[model samples]
Target: MKISSKYLCVILLCIGNTSVFGQSTFGRLKQKATGIAEKVIDKKTDELLEDKSGKKDNTRENPTEKVKKERVKKQNTVYDFQSGSTVLLKEDFLPDVTGQFPMQWYTRSKGEVVEFNDVPGKWLQLYSGTFLSPTVLLKENYTIEFDVIIDFPPNGNYPLPALKIGLYDRGNKGYILSNDYRVKNNVNIILSPYRNELRVKLKSIENNSNKIATENYILPDFTAKLGKPVHIAMDIQKERIRVWIDQEKIFDLPQTVPVSNLLNQLRLELESSNYKNSELGYYISNLCFADGSPDTRSKLLTEGKLESNSILFATNSAKIESDNQGVIKEVAAALKQDNAIRIKVIGHTDSDGTPKQNMALSQKRAESVKRELIEKYGIGENRIETLGKGDTEPVEKNMDPNEKAKNRRVEFVRL
Candidate 1:
């Protein structure tokens, strides 16, 4: 006796669901489905699968000791940047198209999103000369955190890339900062790799006059770790600014710059004039900006819900990204403050993949969040429960890619 095609389809569905909902013993079924589905899917689908698997499709050049030292030191040091309790804007470049400029961002010169073997997510690669900024809500007191990888020449004798990371208050209409004639309150962080120095400059317009302050520091020796990624975190309060490079505190100067005025935009100006080719360039990823300090306890317990897209996870995989752990650590700290509180962690995903795949992925991600809170944050496991909503519920429509990204989030709800 043979089963009908309809029954066979139902059997497959059951198998897939069990594979997703069941214990790790049934994981092979999901893997089998992925293998079978890949054969019939288009090239784009295959690329997406590879990304979710946390593997690069192409080869990459080896990084130097500078990047390696940054990673090694990060493990022992707890990155204390709380990322402003309320995240206003977060850009991981996941919603953007590869090899094309991102939608929310504007650049006078050419800069496009591209995959990097060193990192799990997509990165914005700034060309020889480019000015890039995101058209998002910006506030005066905000925190900016991003990962930068400078591609040094194979022979260290060559001059490395020069990058200028600036914050500008460009009043209203114009796109480029040069054209913005209004009182432009600008704070610029300049990184000169060749001279092994970092500089912070303030150009503020007040009472129709300009006040400027400049601070410079000799960068720590990263000669051995060239080509490796560096993590940069900056905090701007009313009249003070704090900066951190890797595990080291670069500076925390009060009144070094005026922040009384509202500064609303971030700019990345990349230039490699001294370098020979585009290969001697730089990459930026995991750019997150958040302003205002909100009480986590009040936001979580009283409000009953807390949501963030800052929890970085590898594409398609349940493993959380390292640099993204700062936000999760913040969440864990808040929960540890109250032992009586019990919470439910819900995982969500966009409608990019099949329902079964998305369900399994979301469940794994939710479990990952719970695991971090318990083991890393030292929270009691009994107090937390996990659920995967998959793509069943979305906060926004999926027609727009940005909306899809908004839907793919993790929420902590009070139980």
Candidate 2:
């Protein structure tokens, strides 16, 4: 039979429509890939910070506490100091980064003070100190956290930029965080010990009775870079200690001596080598010892730790992150007052599944959560969207069966 021209053109149009539909279907099929990454964190973030504590070992008990239980030293004790738990810091502290302060006997070179040697975005050296102190501060059982910057100069004393922490008593002779002058046959090793200088010498002072010296050891593995900043923390409690550098745990040891006096000095010493004249400086600002200071362990655990995303993932079951309905409600109220916010609901799964399966599962899960949030919880759908990342990105690696189980999860984002 002979077909008319008009009828033939209509048939061609239908053919084109069918081809486009087929392409769309195929594109979606490809996206439903199997075993692709989805979680960018690549580790478990659902785990919360856990505080572990135990009684101090009898080996580290104060001699006075053991031998002379009734007699308590009143002067050097921080137990009665006003600087504990809720102490308020001075306002206008470290007023400027390019200034200095000298008290009757002590001096403070902090905030942002520049040397002729400064690179943009590179930190200026900030420091505060007292020449000498009558007693100690954070002793036996305490936690200290603070931010730090490691700086180096092309010409001066300290040639390397490292985060140096030292503890000594009375005399300035001790191991300053593993200053190995013998490394690489570098002759400047003699000065390496001084690079992490300590004013106190534990061996020199006689402990009331225990053979333990006043010198406290922190971490031997703290490293810093020039022109860079690191938020560092060192905690000593219950014959155990932990170190956090830039919100990362570089060193963790359970048994280190404590700083007995609040007068104890915390310094970020620069690295020194035999390599010629180099000005070494470290930016150490916002020094705090209070239990919940702004820059203390608590701060690091919540804000600093999560943002840095440097903490090692714990190999355990996938823990549900607590979402407070009260807070979410409050957010809705805020939105009513100031319009609304855009939020995204994302779904994820482990790497053990095919991409297509994982993607479909993720999409369904995201939609389920979105429906609940909008209908039951009062979050707006227009202000909210859903995404299924499949197994492409994981907060923690599923290198093993245990980790794979932990990677299956969901997340919420408000923008």
Candidate 3:
């Protein structure tokens, strides 16, 4: 009549009531209970094994997630656009006082030079429906570079303001600050950065007639770049036009401008938006206009020395801007053409810092250029020598910002 504790526990677990199993023998009940427990354990064990093996299969089936991460890591490393050597106009808004319109620029609507808490340097904050232009004469072969910042709250869902940069012919009217000026011929580069998408458009017109050419492109990962400084560069060589946003070349057209049309003005227009200025802000700074693309081969070979402002560097740093590597590539090409040539790479800086600091920075910059030539361009390291002149040997007096920009240059001398 007495039962063991273990069997009694098993009997309670299997049948929950001892009276119901009175007719069955103890041995048969025990065997049936053991089989049921084993089957239930086996079923749960199989489910756990399947769960552990399913993760690998899911990863293999969805490889796009890994590929997307790799693409983002390599997005900013590809750069090829180069700026022009001759400095025409360089404006960092350093001379202009904050909360006032820049004296060197012309704008019809409201805009002022303002400093930001997070961003370095002064920026020209342009309001909506504004036409802003620097007072510089645009030539056929020139380059333009600037930095822009899109300001929007992180939680806001409003669309970004549209931007337009273009070259227009205003005839003999020199630097007119008007919203209704009629442009004879114009080539506009429009940028629309929406919430989830980005659109870039190019439009060219002649004699105020129909558009001659229009091109549009949709850029990826543009919305994530908001609230940061974005560099934009443009190269206009005769009828050919090329535009770059950050490191990506968004537009390249062989014949985008009219041959007969003379473009004399460089303009930046901010299209009207429904949002308030505080909700959607657009800021621009570091506007540089350089004229005449340097003949690198001729200057380095025939003239025996080539000085280039196009091979730009970061502020007081030796790291070269990736977009300015085209100038170095050209130098490498020239050296490759003539295997017997040796050259010295010299670096210079503006008169802003101490002479000792400038000298050290310049030396590092020169060495950086040499390393790029030898490593990236397959040039021999022994054939290139590096030197730094600092601010001692300037091309011009450092009286103004443009003059200082001309002084901060890289020189290649035939040794």
Candidate 4:
């Protein structure tokens, strides 16, 4: 029985409601189709299977071989930061600009709890203009919190214009702050001295940064003041920076700085803001930095009631090229200086590739790091804890492919 090749090809291509044909087992269908086509060809138009040359073509009967499958593992990558355990980039102080302050600090209103009858009016204007952090006061691995009151307009600035805290660099450094406040343009006024508290340690560079997952806490009206302090707190865990405002959180911003702020200069500056009345003033107090935990936010205000868990640091999807030599030096010095300090080398990978492959790659990358610290530098091996988290963690997500690629790298996590 001669079955035309044309019909066989059609069956193979699975065109025209091929769904039903595909449902049949591969072997049974092939045989069924071949048998039916043969019967039809026998009775229908007597077309010869052979060419005009009268030679029978030799075509194979069985189906072609199946496609070969490959695991196709992604590129092997790792990250490490010799960053110190707790790099409290030191102190950040707002110069006292209380006297010449033009804000209407004196509005005859009953004090909420009169320690002083003239508790600064409901508003205070923070010093406006450019005040660089005489020095970088923050490190890549850090938890930061500070208080700023809106003497001028109050917290919710539809586009929180004046309040910005993030990576300050030559270009795009502004990307460091929160987008929640991005909608508020109203500037807060501070009647008293302001303090920027940073509790940071250079952490191991990582791949996936956002923790297992995260959620942000927010308050609608946005403004909170009872002659009390308004808080801005940032907790950076792995790659995500959870934010809170006076026990109530506003929003979260991805960690703009990577495992390391290449510049090693962590700074925060105020936007060019002014007092609503030009004669406002307020106080920013309780500035402190601890190794793990510090009382940053006016925790007392909420009476120990905060919505979300504290987020440590954020992850930056910004693709960057850097060397750990500088960090190595800083960390080496710390290791030498602080006898109680122990350095841990950590590596990270973006959430890409299969779990198995990513795990192996990350681990190898970690060991590679262990060798570098121990061999190249005179660091003790016992102090290092090498751990690799594959694509399970993400510094940043829902970003462009390039950003994901950047996040897919490693970090030097301080243990």
Candidate 5:
């Protein structure tokens, strides 16, 4: 009464499609199915199963793993983008239920919070011709950071729709999703990824309904970044606007945005294209809008203390994210300007885990910051002291994700 591996695979597939199988039985069958699959299935099918099961073959190196490691190494080494300190808006789509529109966002077209197969956390998937806007008024000088994933089938040949992000003045109107989504005063940054290259275009409009500045740049090798998470940062300082995709600064103009423009709305649009919704996927998450460029020198040297929300870390870990190293570099520069200055680095966390775990994590985060300053910036180890406050000293109540983000910050105290 022995069954062939082929029949076993078919049985497993049938069980996976139906809910008649219990959890424990399904788990056992899956293990057996994969175990038998390794011997009978082709290499490509085995690889797909491994990815689905979140397992890896140790005998051979995975090209995806190698690329990820290389990308992380490159990110850690190149640190020029500086995120803003004050939290104006932080949207992770954590509270939104899957298959529903986000509660705190306005969209002219349809979108939903969806969880991906390979990526963690929830993302807001935007359809073509969608205009999504967060329900927050932006400040004059602020920075916007978000992670976007444009997924397309590996074998499908399709045109990629451009993603447009801009700050517009909605004439003090309150959270209106207009039919004609255009404003007189706005600064738009468009990212168009084609077959082999990426075209970045920046255009700013003034109150007079005139296109004041327009710039376009092209970057080769965009195929390397497709179907992966790409970090995008936009910094607007009065009349100047700068944008960075990952580590590369694509746009830096001295006078791209008008100083007199009253920009209060942050809009994200997926331009209309011929591709169907199923063919091309557009997902975005971890959106943060922070106001004002951090004055590290003035805050640390003059005020004697600086609380920075820009130095970000991995979730539940002390590993510092690469793009946030600019704030640390700025602090290091301040220390170098005054050799006699010795400062204390204090780490804080939101109320996510237990008190003891939070305490340990905060301490480790403080040590990580100290290590980065000493190792990367050549700051003396003895000059920097470290401390952790855990969730006890939160600047904001841990009510929502935005408040939690404000609580999770690093402080530099001039000692």
Candidate 6:
């Protein structure tokens, strides 16, 4: 048979294409396999090196928790202040405008939300003799935890910073505006960070049953940790009270506080000192209040509702704060346990804006909660519903401007 040049060329082209395609496919497969094998070898090398070095892998863990665990191990003992089960009033001061007084708190003397070069977020800078109080009804059994930075030099010869944290009541005298240090019926916890000295007085209204307690401790690396954020946790149960600074329990006393004082407010007073210049400062953040007696299972499953103030949101936005993720994780776990159960998340806002605007804000916040549950918590989207009240269904009457804060919260209702 006589073959044309065209047919011969086509036959050659087919053969050439098949050979090229086969080589290309093999090359890709070989490259992929090599890449995977290298990954496996690198992982094995890492494991071997880790075993030889006896170093644990904590790269993926929270940095704050990693530091805490390391510090705990060094102590050779466990010091735990289990937080209150149900959060009541939590103020991260995220919504507060920097360089101004916080909206959620009342201050007689001037204090503003200020930033520190060493700290990560905003803090309330309390000036001397200023008493900052939050508007919330105090329960007899509750826990208060906050972070504070005392700007006094740790080893300076100058006078140290004196900060007083106290609980007081507003009687018929109309919010007794006086020296908090001398206030009767006030339970004061005085902190002197530089000297490592603390004095707590559970003052009685009658002045006869006052109980004073003093504590002196060798602060762990006091000079090294000065001006750094220190966690303060306090628990008050009826007449008994306890306090923890960082990981150490500095105060524990029973029947010291008066059970009948009806202390309805928490106050922070910075005493006047000669070192009250720019270097002399006091700042606080991450204030959390919770029910001293709480049953999480009962609150969620039986009561059919879960309330939290700690689920902080960004200023005028739906973005949840990263520090409050643990609260959402717990709710997600509960929902996952019971596949048949469904929940409706309701968001509320204080009476700060118009009803229409507030309603939209509330709805967006509710949707944000739903998104957090489904995306971060592995919950089914179909099992959740969201609603917003927007200052309509308030738990407390908006009497004082600060009182409006109680109306802003999130609730989970089981359906």
Candidate ranking (lDDT, best to worst): 5, 3, 6, 1, 2, 4
Report the poorest 10 consecutive residues by lDDT, candidate 2: 182-191
* Model 1 agreement with the true structure over 59-102: per-residue lDDT tens digits: 43246755778877875465565566668778888999999989
Per-residue lDDT of candidate 6, residues 1-415 (tens digit)? 2334654564455556766557676566456555666776777767765634677565746899989899767754436466888888888888889999988677667788998675788998888755555655767778889998876655567767568787776532235545444455667777766554433333333243456655444454455556789898987766667778886776666556666556767787777777746777788999888888443333576578888766778867878775242556657867876788899999998888899988988899889989999987679999999999888998888888567767877889999
RMSD of each: 25.3, 28.0, 12.6, 23.3, 20.4, 18.8
**Candidate 5 at 205: error in angstroms?**
0.9
lDDT of each: 0.70, 0.41, 0.78, 0.40, 0.79, 0.72
What is the TM-score of candidate 2? 0.31
Query: Where in model 2 is the C-alpha error above 4 Å?
Result: 1-93, 102-140, 153-164, 167-225, 258-263, 267-280, 292-415
The order of the candidates by TM-score, greatest first, is 3, 5, 6, 1, 2, 4
Q: Report the C-alpha lDDT of model 2 over 388-407, residue by residue, as the tens digit.
A: 88898887787987776567
- The 10 consecutive residues of candidate 3 with the worst lDDT sum are 171-180
With a 3 Å backbone cut-off (N, CA, C), the pairs that clash in candidate 1 are: 52-315, 52-316, 64-225, 64-226, 65-224, 65-225, 65-226, 66-225, 66-226
What stretches of model 5 exceed 4 Å from their correct place?
1-78, 153-158, 171-182, 294-415
126 in model 4: Cα distance from truth in Å?
2.7
- Compute the lDDT for candidate 5: 0.79
Q: List the residue pairs that clash in candidate 3.
A: none
TM-score for all models, in order of appearance: 0.48, 0.31, 0.53, 0.30, 0.52, 0.49
User: After TM-score superposition, what is the CA distance of residue 319 in candidate 2 from its true location, in Å?
Assistant: 11
lDDT by residue for model 4 (1-415), tens: 5566876776676644566565565556667787888788675533465556754433422233211122112111111212234645433233333333322121122111112245442222334332222234443345555555444334323322233343332222233233332211111111222322212122222232321222222234433353455765555532334455555433333432344232223333344433332443333333333233222122212232211111111233222234332334334544554455554544556555667876766666666655655775667878766776776776668267766655555454334
Model 5 is weakest, by summed lDDT over 10 consecutive residues, at: 171-180
Model 3: per-residue lDDT, tens digit, 1-415?
A: 2344675587776566656556556558878767767776777665565645465344344578888777767754566676777888898999999999898777658999999898899998888655546556766788889998876655556656679877777633334345466666888888887655568899887776646556568877766877789999987777777788877888767667765756766677887766778787788999888885644664676788988887888898999886343678778978997999999999999999999999999999999999999888789998999999999999889999999999999999999
